[model samples]
Target: MDMQTINTFLSTTAIELLIKVGAAIIFWIVGRWLIGKVVTLMQAAMNRNQVDPTLTKYLGSIVAIALNITLVLGILGYFGIQTTSFAAMLAGAGVAIGAAWSGMLGNFAAGAFMLVLRPFKVGDFVSVGGITGTVTELGLFATTLLTPDNVYTLVGNGKVFGDTIQNYSHMPVRRVERTAQLAGSVDPLDAIVRLKAAIAQIPNVATSPAPEVNLLDFKLEGPVISVRPYTHTDHYWQVYFDTNEAIARVGKEAGWPAPASTQIHRVTQA
Candidate 1:
């Protein structure tokens, strides 16, 4: 070909390449911005609706990542890069990764269910997967809990869902039991009356159920007093400790002596 024709061809080819590159860059930027806006809007909605913040954040991140991947692929296609072989390779690798990480995927699915069903929430005390504690964090694969003694535990989401869950904090009320031993000489009726009065005085102890005392047995040993009272779940520990103290005090004032074995053999020998 002549120099004029060859130069013209080269210039046209260069202009076409520049246009394609510019279009690809614009697509990437515009796609990214649109994805960002969508993520922001969705996050606002989730917050307004009181959805789990961790879940919202994770979902938003995943969505943004997916959009970026799609934009990158679209840009590559615009630049005349074939994607069929790349897509096949991606599919094969995805299947292999999925097979290798099946357990993790199950956990992720269970975590998603937890977020949607909301059987328990952050700060709620629950027992599941053989672990009990106040939920501190909810993640895609595991949940973090703070135990009663302040120890931290992480439970796999799949195990948690697969096992039975005991949500002690879901209800507003729980029962507290207090047991005491009173001297057999003490009148059972009087002991019961005083014990009930003392339990009633305890703060957070529920009155509707009415605390009751049962005479468990009477042998050579003193009377076994079984006391049970209902209280608000949140105040379970407070009511339990206070009620026990109150019952013991009431028993003392009611002339219920402490349990002691009598020394009768020495007196008989004398």
Candidate 2:
């Protein structure tokens, strides 16, 4: 090739390279700033709606990433790169990744739904899918809890929403049930009447509902007395402890022994 032609070609290549480099850097900086703004907006929106902090942070990150990707593609196209093929490749790769992590995605979707619906919130005691604990944190894929014994547990959001949730803290009032065994000879009618009176006197117990005392069954030891009473949820523990003590004291004062099974046998020798 002639020297003149070589020089012209080199000049064009250098200019093109500089333009591409400048475009990429500008796109990166502007895109990052814009995504940051979007994330801030998302956080503001979440805060306005009282969304959980964990979920708000996760959603903001996702929005930032999506914005960054879009800006990157636009910048690439400005440098004369064909984005159709690139977009297709991205879509294909995304599909593969999505298929591979389908379970995780389901958890993410479920977590989003949980965030919106708010079936339970942090600090609430709930039982779901056989796991009982107080909610500590909620995330896109999992929810963390602290058990009564203070053990940390992480349950997937998908499983949590998919299964039934027993929210013990949802209501202002809760019922406490206790089954006390007595001698079989104890009169069920008298025992129930005394239990009702005893439980009634306990502080925080709801008088409107009236405590229920039922003879559940007669066992080898005694009759099983199912004593249930309604109390304010906040005073659940207090009522539970008081009611238990009251039932025992009342039964003793009423002259009724918890029932017990009786057996008799005879032996004859020839």
Report RMSD (Å) for each prediction in the order shown. 4.1, 3.2
> All candidates' lDDT scores?
0.84, 0.86
TM-score, cand. 2: 0.83
In the range 1-270, model 1's lDDT, one tens digit per residue, is: 999988998799878888898888888788988999999999999999988888899889988887877778778887889978777887899899999999999999999899989889888888989998889988889999998889989999999999998888788767787787776577777777778788888888877777777776765656777888888767878988897788778866766677775445654554
Global fold similarity of model 1 (TM-score): 0.81
After superposition, the stretches of candidate 1 with alpha carbons farther than 4 Å from their true spots are 1-9, 182-187, 215-223, 257-270
Residue-level error in angstroms, candidate 2, position 117:
0.8
Number of the top candidate by TM-score? 2
For residues 102-124, what per-residue lDDT tens digits would candidate 2 score against the true structure? 99999999999998899998888
Model 2, runs deviating above 4 Å:
1-10, 182-187, 214-224, 233-238, 262-270
lDDT score at residue 206, model 2, on the 0-100 scale: 90
